[model samples]
Target: MTAAPGPSRIVRYAMAVAWSSFLSAGVLEALVFAVVDPHELRWFGAAPVELSAEALYTLSFLIFWGVVALGASLALALVNLPADEPKPQRGSPGWPR
Candidate 1:
């Protein structure tokens, strides 16, 4: 019997970021909405927003998800950096002669 192929490394990372961002956005939405009414939100704290409460919630959640995902992606990139290469000190033999 043939074994099923697993997800690629990129796919796995993407999924991880997506899931973490999803959960974070949900929690953020709940906490913020609990303390503030969407109708009271304004644009730049001056002009009134035209979006409905539901639209505001949806937009806010999406913004939160995007920001969280960006952070997660950057973290993953840092974590996945190549480990084999060592930086050469100024006077080390590995440094350019």
Candidate 2:
């Protein structure tokens, strides 16, 4: 049987939550990067030996927010999946009475 079609409140809520989390994380990331030393960013990965603080902050911001946004968007998309519907029996070719 075909599933019923309608707006999904759950999906909307999930998306809202995801975006809110992403925004909050982004703000926090910016604040932390503003004060942390660039040399301390090596934990992220190997890079050129002499990266500047501003460069490190920019890179960190991009990486942090990119991951946050991507992960949240995936979660929200998954939450938006339509509810499952039972299939009709083979002998029943029309809507149930």
Candidate 3:
């Protein structure tokens, strides 16, 4: 018999990473960047930062999006992990084991 259809693995992974990137790089990091402009950034000993706003934003987006994507995919994988052993029915002989 044909099995019921469901989302393919790629579709599930893409959806997760896309949402994760949007929330991380688009929303959360955007809020933080708004409050902490690159021009206002400082280095050790109070030295002015060197990176331009564009470069900083790009770097931050990459880092945040990568982390969120990894986390999302890993979580999805873990959530779908198969059972190590078959579950025993309540009245089955294996149930006591």
The best candidate in terms of TM-score: 1
The true-structure Cα RMSD of candidate 1 reads 10.0
**Stronger candidate by lDDT (1 vs 3):** 1
Worst 10 residues of 2 by lDDT: 40-49
Candidate 3 Cα lDDT to native: 0.77
Kindly list the per-residue Cα lDDT of model 1 for residues 1-97, writing each as its tens digit: 6568678668888999999999999999999999998878788899888999989999999999999999999999888555444544657685357
Which window of ten consecutive residues has the lowest lDDT sum in model 3? Answer: 81-90
Q: What TM-score, computed on C-alpha atoms, does each candidate reach?
A: 0.78, 0.45, 0.59
lDDT of 2: 0.68
- Candidates in order: C-alpha RMSD to true structure: 10.0, 7.6, 7.4
Model 3 pairs whose backbones collide: none
Identify the candidate with maximal lDDT: 1
Q: With candidate 3 superimposed using the best TM-score fit, by how many Å does residue 39's alpha carbon deviate from the native?
A: 1.2
